[model samples]
Target: MDLQQMRYVVAVAETASFTRAAERCHVVQSALSHQVARLEKELGARLFERTSRRVRLTAAGEAFLPAARQALEAAERARAEVAAASGEIRGRLTVGSIPTVTAVDLPAVLRDYRGRYPQVRISLRAGSSERLVDMVRDGTLDAAFLGVPPGFRIQGVHDRELAHGQHVAVVAPDHPLAAEHEVDLRHLAEEAFVDFADGSAARAQSDQAFAAAGLRREVAFEVSGVELMARMVRHGLGVALLPATFAAELHGLRCVPITNGPVRVERLVWSRFTPSPAASAFLALLGVGAPPTAE
Candidate 1:
Protein backbone atom coordinates (compact mmCIF):
# COMPACT_ATOMS: atom_id res chain seq x y z
CA MET A 1 0.00 0.00 0.00
CA ASP A 2 1.32 3.45 0.95
CA LEU A 3 4.88 4.11 2.16
CA GLN A 4 3.72 5.12 5.64
CA GLN A 5 1.80 1.88 6.08
CA MET A 6 4.76 -0.09 4.75
CA ARG A 7 7.03 1.74 7.19
CA TYR A 8 4.74 0.90 10.13
CA VAL A 9 4.57 -2.75 9.06
CA VAL A 10 8.33 -2.99 8.68
CA ALA A 11 8.92 -1.34 12.02
CA VAL A 12 6.41 -3.62 13.76
CA ALA A 13 7.90 -6.70 12.09
CA GLU A 14 11.42 -5.74 13.10
CA THR A 15 10.58 -4.90 16.71
CA ALA A 16 7.96 -7.65 17.11
CA SER A 17 5.83 -5.31 19.22
CA PHE A 18 3.41 -2.62 18.18
CA THR A 19 4.22 -0.49 21.23
CA ARG A 20 7.96 -0.67 20.65
CA ALA A 21 7.59 -0.06 16.92
CA ALA A 22 5.45 2.99 17.65
CA GLU A 23 8.15 4.31 19.97
CA ARG A 24 10.86 3.72 17.35
CA CYS A 25 8.83 5.33 14.60
CA HIS A 26 8.03 8.26 16.92
CA VAL A 27 4.27 7.87 16.55
CA VAL A 28 1.44 6.95 18.90
CA GLN A 29 0.69 3.25 19.24
CA SER A 30 -2.96 3.65 18.20
CA ALA A 31 -2.13 5.44 14.93
CA LEU A 32 0.59 2.93 14.03
CA SER A 33 -1.76 0.01 14.70
CA HIS A 34 -4.52 1.65 12.68
CA GLN A 35 -2.20 2.13 9.71
CA VAL A 36 -0.97 -1.50 9.81
CA ALA A 37 -4.57 -2.79 10.14
CA ARG A 38 -5.67 -0.68 7.17
CA LEU A 39 -2.80 -2.00 5.09
CA GLU A 40 -3.62 -5.61 6.05
CA LYS A 41 -7.28 -5.10 5.10
CA GLU A 42 -6.29 -3.69 1.70
CA LEU A 43 -4.02 -6.64 1.07
CA GLY A 44 -6.61 -9.14 2.37
CA ALA A 45 -3.98 -10.87 4.54
CA ARG A 46 -2.86 -10.85 8.13
CA LEU A 47 0.77 -9.88 8.42
CA PHE A 48 1.29 -10.59 12.09
CA GLU A 49 0.03 -13.09 14.64
CA ARG A 50 -0.48 -10.96 17.74
CA THR A 51 -0.70 -12.68 21.10
CA SER A 52 -0.65 -11.05 24.52
CA ARG A 53 2.83 -12.41 25.12
CA ARG A 54 4.49 -11.93 21.76
CA VAL A 55 4.09 -10.86 18.14
CA ARG A 56 5.31 -13.02 15.28
CA LEU A 57 5.20 -12.67 11.51
CA THR A 58 2.62 -14.75 9.68
CA ALA A 59 3.30 -16.56 6.42
CA ALA A 60 2.31 -13.57 4.31
CA GLY A 61 4.38 -11.22 6.45
CA GLU A 62 7.43 -13.43 6.00
CA ALA A 63 7.04 -13.19 2.24
CA PHE A 64 6.34 -9.45 2.31
CA LEU A 65 9.17 -8.30 4.58
CA PRO A 66 12.03 -8.47 2.08
CA ALA A 67 10.14 -6.60 -0.61
CA ALA A 68 9.14 -3.93 1.90
CA ARG A 69 12.75 -3.35 2.89
CA GLN A 70 13.84 -3.22 -0.75
CA ALA A 71 11.17 -0.68 -1.56
CA LEU A 72 12.29 1.56 1.31
CA GLU A 73 15.93 1.26 0.25
CA ALA A 74 15.04 2.13 -3.34
CA ALA A 75 13.12 5.20 -2.22
CA GLU A 76 16.03 6.37 -0.07
CA ARG A 77 18.45 5.83 -2.91
CA ALA A 78 16.28 7.79 -5.28
CA ARG A 79 16.17 10.71 -2.87
CA ALA A 80 19.92 10.58 -2.35
CA GLU A 81 20.61 10.45 -6.09
CA VAL A 82 18.41 13.42 -6.68
CA ALA A 83 20.15 15.39 -3.94
CA ALA A 84 23.53 14.45 -5.37
CA ALA A 85 22.50 15.71 -8.80
CA SER A 86 21.70 19.04 -7.14
CA GLY A 87 25.26 19.16 -5.70
CA GLU A 88 24.15 18.23 -2.17
CA ILE A 89 25.11 14.79 -0.88
CA ARG A 90 22.71 13.50 1.79
CA GLY A 91 22.37 9.86 2.87
CA ARG A 92 23.28 7.34 5.53
CA LEU A 93 26.80 5.92 5.27
CA THR A 94 27.61 2.77 7.20
CA VAL A 95 31.25 1.73 7.47
CA GLY A 96 32.89 -1.33 9.02
CA SER A 97 36.44 -1.93 10.17
CA ILE A 98 38.59 -4.30 12.16
CA PRO A 99 39.71 -3.12 15.59
CA THR A 100 43.38 -3.13 14.68
CA VAL A 101 43.13 -1.02 11.56
CA THR A 102 46.40 0.82 10.83
CA ALA A 103 46.41 1.31 7.07
CA VAL A 104 44.32 4.48 7.26
CA ASP A 105 43.76 6.99 10.04
CA LEU A 106 40.07 6.16 10.28
CA PRO A 107 39.11 8.73 12.87
CA ALA A 108 40.79 11.53 10.98
CA VAL A 109 39.30 10.37 7.68
CA LEU A 110 35.84 10.25 9.21
CA ARG A 111 36.34 13.66 10.72
CA ASP A 112 37.31 15.14 7.35
CA TYR A 113 34.42 13.48 5.60
CA ARG A 114 32.00 14.74 8.20
CA GLY A 115 33.36 18.22 7.87
CA ARG A 116 33.03 18.15 4.11
CA TYR A 117 29.58 16.56 4.03
CA PRO A 118 27.83 17.45 7.23
CA GLN A 119 24.46 16.47 5.79
CA VAL A 120 25.36 12.77 5.61
CA ARG A 121 24.68 10.61 8.63
CA ILE A 122 27.67 8.38 9.41
CA SER A 123 27.91 5.19 11.46
CA LEU A 124 30.81 2.87 12.08
CA ARG A 125 30.97 -0.78 13.13
CA ALA A 126 33.94 -2.72 14.45
CA GLY A 127 34.18 -6.37 13.50
CA SER A 128 36.53 -9.09 12.33
CA SER A 129 37.73 -8.92 8.74
CA GLU A 130 35.70 -12.00 7.87
CA ARG A 131 32.50 -10.57 9.28
CA LEU A 132 33.12 -7.16 7.79
CA VAL A 133 33.68 -8.68 4.36
CA ASP A 134 30.42 -10.56 4.58
CA MET A 135 28.59 -7.36 5.66
CA VAL A 136 29.99 -5.48 2.68
CA ARG A 137 28.96 -8.28 0.30
CA ASP A 138 25.41 -8.26 1.69
CA GLY A 139 25.07 -4.46 1.45
CA THR A 140 24.79 -4.05 5.23
CA LEU A 141 27.95 -2.00 5.07
CA ASP A 142 28.54 0.67 2.44
CA ALA A 143 32.28 0.01 2.68
CA ALA A 144 34.71 -1.72 5.01
CA PHE A 145 38.34 -2.00 5.97
CA LEU A 146 39.69 -5.52 6.21
CA GLY A 147 42.94 -7.27 7.09
CA VAL A 148 43.82 -10.77 5.98
CA PRO A 149 46.85 -12.95 5.39
CA PRO A 150 48.97 -11.81 2.48
CA GLY A 151 47.87 -13.09 -0.95
CA PHE A 152 44.36 -13.88 0.34
CA ARG A 153 42.02 -12.54 -2.32
CA ILE A 154 38.54 -11.49 -1.26
CA GLN A 155 35.74 -12.78 -3.45
CA GLY A 156 32.52 -11.10 -4.69
CA VAL A 157 33.60 -7.52 -3.91
CA HIS A 158 35.84 -4.81 -5.24
CA ASP A 159 38.95 -4.42 -3.09
CA ARG A 160 42.11 -2.40 -3.06
CA GLU A 161 45.18 -3.13 -1.00
CA LEU A 162 45.80 -0.32 1.49
CA ALA A 163 48.89 -1.58 3.29
CA HIS A 164 51.04 -4.73 3.56
CA GLY A 165 53.25 -5.56 6.50
CA GLN A 166 54.50 -8.34 8.79
CA HIS A 167 53.61 -9.18 12.35
CA VAL A 168 56.16 -8.66 15.08
CA ALA A 169 56.56 -10.57 18.32
CA VAL A 170 55.43 -8.65 21.42
CA VAL A 171 56.52 -9.57 24.93
CA ALA A 172 56.40 -8.14 28.41
CA PRO A 173 59.39 -6.13 29.52
CA ASP A 174 60.56 -8.89 31.91
CA HIS A 175 59.97 -11.74 29.45
CA PRO A 176 62.90 -13.82 28.27
CA LEU A 177 62.60 -12.94 24.57
CA ALA A 178 61.96 -9.25 25.22
CA ALA A 179 65.62 -8.39 24.69
CA GLU A 180 65.88 -10.00 21.32
CA HIS A 181 66.09 -7.57 18.41
CA GLU A 182 64.72 -10.13 16.02
CA VAL A 183 63.24 -13.61 16.35
CA ASP A 184 61.87 -16.24 14.04
CA LEU A 185 58.54 -18.04 14.18
CA ARG A 186 60.20 -21.23 15.41
CA HIS A 187 61.62 -19.41 18.42
CA LEU A 188 58.36 -17.62 19.25
CA ALA A 189 56.40 -20.85 18.79
CA GLU A 190 57.80 -22.25 22.03
CA GLU A 191 56.16 -19.56 24.20
CA ALA A 192 52.53 -19.34 25.28
CA PHE A 193 50.78 -16.74 23.17
CA VAL A 194 47.80 -14.41 23.32
CA ASP A 195 45.84 -14.45 20.11
CA PHE A 196 42.51 -13.53 18.55
CA ALA A 197 39.55 -15.90 18.51
CA ASP A 198 40.02 -19.14 16.60
CA GLY A 199 39.11 -19.08 12.86
CA SER A 200 39.06 -15.28 12.61
CA ALA A 201 41.06 -13.64 9.85
CA ALA A 202 43.47 -12.14 12.42
CA ARG A 203 44.07 -15.57 13.97
CA ALA A 204 44.43 -17.16 10.55
CA GLN A 205 47.35 -14.87 9.78
CA SER A 206 49.38 -16.40 12.58
CA ASP A 207 47.94 -19.91 12.23
CA GLN A 208 48.97 -20.16 8.59
CA ALA A 209 52.45 -18.93 9.41
CA PHE A 210 53.00 -21.47 12.19
CA ALA A 211 51.57 -24.29 10.10
CA ALA A 212 53.85 -23.35 7.24
CA ALA A 213 56.89 -23.27 9.52
CA GLY A 214 55.97 -26.67 10.95
CA LEU A 215 55.46 -25.12 14.36
CA ARG A 216 52.53 -25.25 16.73
CA ARG A 217 52.07 -22.82 19.58
CA GLU A 218 49.64 -22.75 22.47
CA VAL A 219 47.34 -19.73 22.76
CA ALA A 220 46.73 -19.40 26.46
CA PHE A 221 44.61 -16.28 26.15
CA GLU A 222 42.13 -15.60 23.41
CA VAL A 223 40.84 -12.05 23.07
CA SER A 224 38.59 -10.12 20.70
CA GLY A 225 40.08 -6.67 21.09
CA VAL A 226 43.64 -5.51 20.49
CA GLU A 227 43.67 -3.67 23.82
CA LEU A 228 42.91 -6.89 25.67
CA MET A 229 45.57 -8.80 23.77
CA ALA A 230 48.12 -6.09 24.57
CA ARG A 231 47.10 -6.12 28.24
CA MET A 232 47.56 -9.87 28.44
CA VAL A 233 51.04 -9.61 26.95
CA ARG A 234 51.92 -6.70 29.26
CA HIS A 235 50.95 -8.73 32.32
CA GLY A 236 53.35 -11.51 31.31
CA LEU A 237 50.45 -13.90 30.73
CA GLY A 238 51.67 -14.65 27.20
CA VAL A 239 53.36 -13.21 24.17
CA ALA A 240 51.51 -11.98 21.06
CA LEU A 241 52.13 -11.45 17.38
CA LEU A 242 50.82 -8.08 16.23
CA PRO A 243 51.28 -5.80 13.30
CA ALA A 244 54.44 -3.75 13.73
CA THR A 245 52.58 -0.46 13.46
CA PHE A 246 49.93 -1.53 15.92
CA ALA A 247 52.42 -2.99 18.38
CA ALA A 248 54.24 0.30 18.49
CA GLU A 249 51.14 1.87 20.04
CA LEU A 250 51.27 -0.35 23.12
CA HIS A 251 53.42 0.85 25.98
CA GLY A 252 55.32 -1.32 28.51
CA LEU A 253 55.88 -3.97 25.85
CA ARG A 254 58.83 -5.02 23.73
CA CYS A 255 58.37 -5.40 20.00
CA VAL A 256 60.88 -7.65 18.30
CA PRO A 257 60.94 -7.98 14.55
CA ILE A 258 60.20 -11.48 13.27
CA THR A 259 62.51 -12.88 10.67
CA ASN A 260 59.90 -15.37 9.48
CA GLY A 261 56.53 -14.02 10.54
CA PRO A 262 53.02 -13.81 9.24
CA VAL A 263 52.32 -11.02 6.78
CA ARG A 264 49.03 -9.13 6.80
CA VAL A 265 47.45 -7.15 3.99
CA GLU A 266 45.00 -4.39 4.81
CA ARG A 267 42.41 -3.55 2.23
CA LEU A 268 39.26 -1.50 1.55
CA VAL A 269 36.29 -3.38 0.15
CA TRP A 270 32.92 -2.31 -1.25
CA SER A 271 30.03 -3.87 -3.11
CA ARG A 272 30.56 -4.76 -6.78
CA PHE A 273 27.43 -2.80 -7.69
CA THR A 274 27.32 0.98 -8.02
CA PRO A 275 28.14 2.70 -4.74
CA SER A 276 25.80 5.07 -2.92
CA PRO A 277 26.56 8.77 -3.22
CA ALA A 278 27.88 8.91 0.32
CA ALA A 279 30.10 5.88 -0.27
CA SER A 280 31.40 7.35 -3.52
CA ALA A 281 32.26 10.62 -1.79
CA PHE A 282 34.05 8.79 1.00
CA LEU A 283 35.99 6.68 -1.48
CA ALA A 284 36.99 9.76 -3.40
CA LEU A 285 38.35 11.24 -0.16
CA LEU A 286 40.53 8.12 0.14
CA GLY A 287 41.82 8.75 -3.40
CA VAL A 288 40.03 5.72 -4.77
CA GLY A 289 38.52 5.96 -8.25
CA ALA A 290 35.00 5.05 -9.24
CA PRO A 291 33.71 1.72 -8.00
CA PRO A 292 33.40 -1.14 -10.50
CA THR A 293 29.95 -2.45 -11.43
CA ALA A 294 28.89 -6.08 -11.29
CA GLU A 295 29.57 -8.05 -14.46
Candidate 2:
Protein backbone atom coordinates (compact mmCIF):
# COMPACT_ATOMS: atom_id res chain seq x y z
CA MET A 1 0.00 0.00 0.00
CA ASP A 2 2.80 2.40 0.95
CA LEU A 3 6.09 2.86 -0.87
CA GLN A 4 8.04 1.41 2.06
CA GLN A 5 5.84 -1.68 2.18
CA MET A 6 6.04 -2.09 -1.58
CA ARG A 7 9.82 -1.76 -1.42
CA TYR A 8 10.00 -4.47 1.20
CA VAL A 9 7.78 -6.80 -0.82
CA VAL A 10 9.77 -6.25 -3.98
CA ALA A 11 13.03 -6.81 -2.17
CA VAL A 12 11.75 -10.04 -0.63
CA ALA A 13 10.42 -11.26 -3.97
CA GLU A 14 13.72 -10.59 -5.72
CA THR A 15 15.95 -12.12 -3.06
CA ALA A 16 13.45 -14.93 -2.35
CA SER A 17 14.35 -14.70 1.34
CA PHE A 18 13.11 -12.26 3.96
CA THR A 19 16.45 -12.42 5.78
CA ARG A 20 18.42 -11.50 2.67
CA ALA A 21 15.85 -8.89 1.66
CA ALA A 22 16.08 -7.19 5.05
CA GLU A 23 19.85 -7.11 4.78
CA ARG A 24 19.62 -5.58 1.30
CA CYS A 25 17.12 -2.95 2.48
CA HIS A 26 19.29 -2.27 5.55
CA VAL A 27 16.56 -3.24 7.97
CA VAL A 28 15.91 -6.01 10.46
CA GLN A 29 14.07 -9.13 9.25
CA SER A 30 11.13 -8.78 11.63
CA ALA A 31 10.48 -5.18 10.74
CA LEU A 32 10.46 -5.92 7.01
CA SER A 33 8.19 -8.91 7.55
CA HIS A 34 5.80 -6.81 9.62
CA GLN A 35 5.44 -4.28 6.80
CA VAL A 36 4.75 -6.94 4.16
CA ALA A 37 2.26 -8.73 6.40
CA ARG A 38 0.49 -5.49 7.05
CA LEU A 39 0.27 -4.80 3.32
CA GLU A 40 -1.11 -8.30 2.70
CA LYS A 41 -3.76 -7.76 5.40
CA GLU A 42 -4.77 -4.45 3.87
CA LEU A 43 -5.15 -6.08 0.45
CA GLY A 44 -6.90 -9.14 1.90
CA ALA A 45 -4.61 -11.42 -0.10
CA ARG A 46 -1.32 -13.17 0.62
CA LEU A 47 1.46 -12.13 -1.72
CA PHE A 48 3.98 -14.81 -0.88
CA GLU A 49 3.72 -18.36 0.34
CA ARG A 50 6.39 -18.72 3.00
CA THR A 51 7.94 -21.94 4.10
CA SER A 52 10.73 -22.96 6.47
CA ARG A 53 13.11 -23.72 3.60
CA ARG A 54 11.98 -21.65 0.64
CA VAL A 55 9.73 -18.72 -0.23
CA ARG A 56 7.73 -18.46 -3.44
CA LEU A 57 5.42 -15.82 -4.83
CA THR A 58 1.72 -16.64 -4.81
CA ALA A 59 -0.40 -16.04 -7.90
CA ALA A 60 -1.39 -12.69 -6.46
CA GLY A 61 2.25 -11.78 -5.91
CA GLU A 62 3.09 -12.62 -9.51
CA ALA A 63 0.23 -10.41 -10.66
CA PHE A 64 1.16 -7.57 -8.32
CA LEU A 65 4.92 -7.62 -8.99
CA PRO A 66 4.91 -5.76 -12.31
CA ALA A 67 2.74 -2.87 -11.14
CA ALA A 68 4.75 -2.66 -7.93
CA ARG A 69 7.94 -2.25 -9.95
CA GLN A 70 6.37 0.39 -12.17
CA ALA A 71 5.24 2.31 -9.10
CA LEU A 72 8.73 2.30 -7.64
CA GLU A 73 10.21 3.42 -10.94
CA ALA A 74 7.68 6.24 -11.20
CA ALA A 75 8.51 7.45 -7.69
CA GLU A 76 12.23 7.36 -8.46
CA ARG A 77 11.68 9.27 -11.69
CA ALA A 78 9.77 11.94 -9.84
CA ARG A 79 12.71 12.43 -7.49
CA ALA A 80 15.21 12.46 -10.36
CA GLU A 81 13.20 15.03 -12.33
CA VAL A 82 13.06 17.37 -9.35
CA ALA A 83 16.81 17.07 -8.89
CA ALA A 84 17.38 17.73 -12.60
CA ALA A 85 15.28 20.91 -12.44
CA SER A 86 17.63 22.11 -9.70
CA GLY A 87 20.65 21.73 -12.05
CA GLU A 88 21.58 18.33 -10.68
CA ILE A 89 20.93 14.84 -12.08
CA ARG A 90 20.29 12.08 -9.58
CA GLY A 91 19.17 8.55 -10.54
CA ARG A 92 20.32 4.99 -11.07
CA LEU A 93 21.66 4.20 -14.53
CA THR A 94 21.85 0.51 -15.35
CA VAL A 95 23.79 -0.33 -18.48
CA GLY A 96 24.46 -3.62 -20.24
CA SER A 97 27.01 -4.52 -22.91
CA ILE A 98 28.37 -7.41 -24.87
CA PRO A 99 31.90 -8.48 -23.99
CA THR A 100 33.03 -7.73 -27.55
CA VAL A 101 32.14 -4.04 -27.41
CA THR A 102 34.73 -1.90 -29.24
CA ALA A 103 32.91 1.11 -30.65
CA VAL A 104 33.49 3.07 -27.44
CA ASP A 105 35.89 2.93 -24.53
CA LEU A 106 33.23 1.94 -21.98
CA PRO A 107 35.36 2.28 -18.89
CA ALA A 108 36.59 5.74 -19.88
CA VAL A 109 33.06 6.89 -20.74
CA LEU A 110 31.69 5.62 -17.41
CA ARG A 111 34.49 7.37 -15.57
CA ASP A 112 33.61 10.66 -17.25
CA TYR A 113 29.90 10.19 -16.56
CA ARG A 114 30.63 9.57 -12.90
CA GLY A 115 32.77 12.69 -12.71
CA ARG A 116 30.08 14.83 -14.32
CA TYR A 117 27.22 13.48 -12.21
CA PRO A 118 28.63 12.16 -9.00
CA GLN A 119 25.12 12.09 -7.52
CA VAL A 120 24.06 9.37 -10.00
CA ARG A 121 24.64 5.68 -9.35
CA ILE A 122 25.96 3.64 -12.27
CA SER A 123 26.00 -0.13 -12.78
CA LEU A 124 27.16 -2.22 -15.70
CA ARG A 125 26.38 -5.77 -16.75
CA ALA A 126 28.17 -7.87 -19.38
CA GLY A 127 25.98 -10.22 -21.38
CA SER A 128 25.23 -11.52 -24.84
CA SER A 129 23.82 -9.06 -27.33
CA GLU A 130 20.48 -10.86 -27.52
CA ARG A 131 20.07 -10.82 -23.75
CA LEU A 132 21.19 -7.21 -23.49
CA VAL A 133 18.61 -6.16 -26.07
CA ASP A 134 15.90 -7.97 -24.18
CA MET A 135 16.91 -6.22 -20.97
CA VAL A 136 16.64 -2.84 -22.64
CA ARG A 137 13.18 -3.62 -24.02
CA ASP A 138 11.98 -4.83 -20.62
CA GLY A 139 13.21 -1.79 -18.65
CA THR A 140 15.67 -3.92 -16.74
CA LEU A 141 18.47 -1.82 -18.25
CA ASP A 142 18.43 1.88 -19.06
CA ALA A 143 20.74 1.48 -22.04
CA ALA A 144 22.96 -1.09 -23.71
CA PHE A 145 25.68 -1.56 -26.28
CA LEU A 146 24.98 -4.35 -28.76
CA GLY A 147 26.71 -5.98 -31.73
CA VAL A 148 24.70 -7.87 -34.31
CA PRO A 149 25.08 -8.98 -37.91
CA PRO A 150 25.20 -6.23 -40.44
CA GLY A 151 21.73 -5.24 -41.77
CA PHE A 152 19.96 -6.72 -38.78
CA ARG A 153 17.53 -4.18 -37.40
CA ILE A 154 16.48 -4.34 -33.77
CA GLN A 155 12.76 -3.88 -33.23
CA GLY A 156 10.71 -2.54 -30.29
CA VAL A 157 13.47 -0.23 -29.08
CA HIS A 158 15.24 2.91 -30.21
CA ASP A 159 18.74 2.21 -31.51
CA ARG A 160 21.52 3.91 -33.44
CA GLU A 161 24.46 2.26 -35.15
CA LEU A 162 27.76 3.28 -33.59
CA ALA A 163 30.22 1.39 -35.81
CA HIS A 164 30.37 -1.21 -38.53
CA GLY A 165 33.35 -3.42 -39.37
CA GLN A 166 34.35 -6.83 -40.61
CA HIS A 167 35.54 -9.73 -38.50
CA VAL A 168 39.06 -11.13 -38.93
CA ALA A 169 40.30 -14.66 -38.56
CA VAL A 170 42.30 -15.27 -35.38
CA VAL A 171 44.89 -18.02 -35.29
CA ALA A 172 47.74 -19.19 -33.11
CA PRO A 173 51.13 -17.75 -33.98
CA ASP A 174 52.40 -21.14 -35.16
CA HIS A 175 49.27 -22.13 -37.06
CA PRO A 176 49.72 -22.66 -40.79
CA LEU A 177 47.19 -20.00 -41.81
CA ALA A 178 48.82 -17.52 -39.47
CA ALA A 179 51.49 -16.87 -42.09
CA GLU A 180 48.99 -15.95 -44.74
CA HIS A 181 48.56 -12.31 -45.60
CA GLU A 182 44.87 -12.80 -46.17
CA VAL A 183 42.37 -15.64 -46.35
CA ASP A 184 38.83 -16.02 -47.50
CA LEU A 185 35.94 -17.88 -45.91
CA ARG A 186 36.50 -20.79 -48.30
CA HIS A 187 40.02 -21.33 -47.00
CA LEU A 188 39.06 -20.87 -43.35
CA ALA A 189 36.25 -23.38 -43.75
CA GLU A 190 38.80 -26.15 -43.97
CA GLU A 191 40.04 -25.43 -40.46
CA ALA A 192 38.30 -26.37 -37.21
CA PHE A 193 36.75 -23.43 -35.40
CA VAL A 194 36.28 -22.15 -31.89
CA ASP A 195 33.17 -19.98 -31.93
CA PHE A 196 30.43 -18.65 -29.73
CA ALA A 197 27.72 -21.00 -28.65
CA ASP A 198 25.48 -22.22 -31.43
CA GLY A 199 22.38 -20.04 -32.06
CA SER A 200 23.79 -16.98 -30.27
CA ALA A 201 23.74 -13.60 -31.98
CA ALA A 202 27.56 -13.54 -31.98
CA ARG A 203 27.68 -16.92 -33.70
CA ALA A 204 25.00 -15.90 -36.20
CA GLN A 205 27.27 -13.35 -37.79
CA SER A 206 29.73 -16.00 -38.93
CA ASP A 207 27.02 -18.54 -39.59
CA GLN A 208 25.20 -16.26 -41.99
CA ALA A 209 28.43 -15.36 -43.77
CA PHE A 210 29.46 -18.96 -44.31
CA ALA A 211 25.99 -19.96 -45.42
CA ALA A 212 25.97 -17.10 -47.91
CA ALA A 213 29.34 -18.22 -49.29
CA GLY A 214 27.80 -21.65 -49.96
CA LEU A 215 30.17 -23.28 -47.46
CA ARG A 216 30.02 -25.03 -44.13
CA ARG A 217 32.59 -25.04 -41.32
CA GLU A 218 33.09 -27.22 -38.32
CA VAL A 219 32.78 -25.57 -34.90
CA ALA A 220 35.00 -27.78 -32.76
CA PHE A 221 34.57 -25.89 -29.51
CA GLU A 222 31.68 -23.81 -28.27
CA VAL A 223 32.40 -21.26 -25.56
CA SER A 224 30.59 -18.34 -23.96
CA GLY A 225 33.26 -15.77 -23.15
CA VAL A 226 35.62 -14.21 -25.68
CA GLU A 227 38.56 -14.80 -23.35
CA LEU A 228 37.97 -18.54 -23.53
CA MET A 229 37.67 -18.34 -27.29
CA ALA A 230 41.04 -16.58 -27.41
CA ARG A 231 42.55 -19.27 -25.19
CA MET A 232 41.26 -21.99 -27.50
CA VAL A 233 42.78 -20.29 -30.52
CA ARG A 234 46.10 -19.71 -28.70
CA HIS A 235 46.42 -23.42 -27.96
CA GLY A 236 45.80 -24.22 -31.65
CA LEU A 237 42.53 -25.93 -30.79
CA GLY A 238 40.77 -23.96 -33.50
CA VAL A 239 40.63 -20.66 -35.29
CA ALA A 240 38.06 -17.93 -34.50
CA LEU A 241 36.50 -14.97 -36.24
CA LEU A 242 36.23 -11.92 -34.02
CA PRO A 243 35.72 -8.19 -34.47
CA ALA A 244 38.93 -6.49 -35.64
CA THR A 245 39.06 -4.11 -32.69
CA PHE A 246 38.40 -6.82 -30.14
CA ALA A 247 40.92 -9.17 -31.73
CA ALA A 248 43.65 -6.55 -31.45
CA GLU A 249 43.52 -6.84 -27.67
CA LEU A 250 44.15 -10.59 -27.48
CA HIS A 251 47.76 -11.62 -26.98
CA GLY A 252 49.41 -14.67 -28.55
CA LEU A 253 47.10 -14.57 -31.57
CA ARG A 254 47.62 -13.66 -35.20
CA CYS A 255 44.87 -11.69 -36.87
CA VAL A 256 44.63 -12.43 -40.58
CA PRO A 257 42.34 -10.28 -42.64
CA ILE A 258 39.62 -12.22 -44.38
CA THR A 259 38.99 -11.37 -48.01
CA ASN A 260 35.32 -12.09 -47.48
CA GLY A 261 34.33 -11.88 -43.83
CA PRO A 262 31.31 -11.40 -41.65
CA VAL A 263 30.51 -7.76 -40.92
CA ARG A 264 29.33 -6.74 -37.44
CA VAL A 265 27.34 -3.63 -36.57
CA GLU A 266 27.62 -2.14 -33.10
CA ARG A 267 24.70 -0.11 -31.85
CA LEU A 268 23.43 1.70 -28.78
CA VAL A 269 19.85 0.90 -27.74
CA TRP A 270 17.51 2.53 -25.22
CA SER A 271 13.86 2.32 -24.39
CA ARG A 272 11.42 3.89 -26.82
CA PHE A 273 9.71 5.54 -23.87
CA THR A 274 11.17 8.49 -22.01
CA PRO A 275 14.48 7.67 -20.38
CA SER A 276 15.67 8.56 -16.90
CA PRO A 277 17.41 11.91 -16.53
CA ALA A 278 20.71 10.14 -16.04
CA ALA A 279 20.23 8.13 -19.23
CA SER A 280 19.34 11.27 -21.16
CA ALA A 281 22.52 12.91 -19.94
CA PHE A 282 24.50 9.85 -21.01
CA LEU A 283 23.01 10.03 -24.48
CA ALA A 284 23.97 13.69 -24.62
CA LEU A 285 27.54 12.80 -23.67
CA LEU A 286 27.59 10.44 -26.65
CA GLY A 287 26.20 13.19 -28.91
CA VAL A 288 22.90 11.41 -29.25
CA GLY A 289 19.55 13.13 -28.92
CA ALA A 290 16.65 12.24 -26.68
CA PRO A 291 14.72 9.03 -27.33
CA PRO A 292 11.47 9.27 -29.25
CA THR A 293 8.12 8.83 -27.55
CA ALA A 294 6.77 5.30 -27.62
CA GLU A 295 4.35 4.63 -30.47
Q: Which candidate leads the pack in lDDT? A: 2
lDDT of 2 by residue, 96-191 (tens): 999989999999999999999999999999999899989999999989999999877688888999999899999999999989999999999999
RMSD of each: 2.0, 1.7
TM-score of each: 0.91, 0.94
Clash counts per candidate, in order, are 0, 0
Candidate 1 structure, TM-score to reference:
0.91
Model 1: lDDT of residue 148: 95
Cα lDDT of candidate 1 equals 0.92
lDDT of 2: 0.93
Query: What is each predicted model's overall lDDT from 0 to 1?
Result: 0.92, 0.93
Residues 1-295, model 1: lDDT tens digits: 8888889999999899999999999999999999999989999999999999999999999999999988888898899999999999988899999988899999999999999999999999999998898999999998999989987769988899999989999999999898888998888888999999998889999999999999999999899999988888889999999999988888889999998799999999988889999999999999988787777
Once fitted onto the true fold, the runs of candidate 2 whose alpha carbons sit more than 4 angstroms away are: none
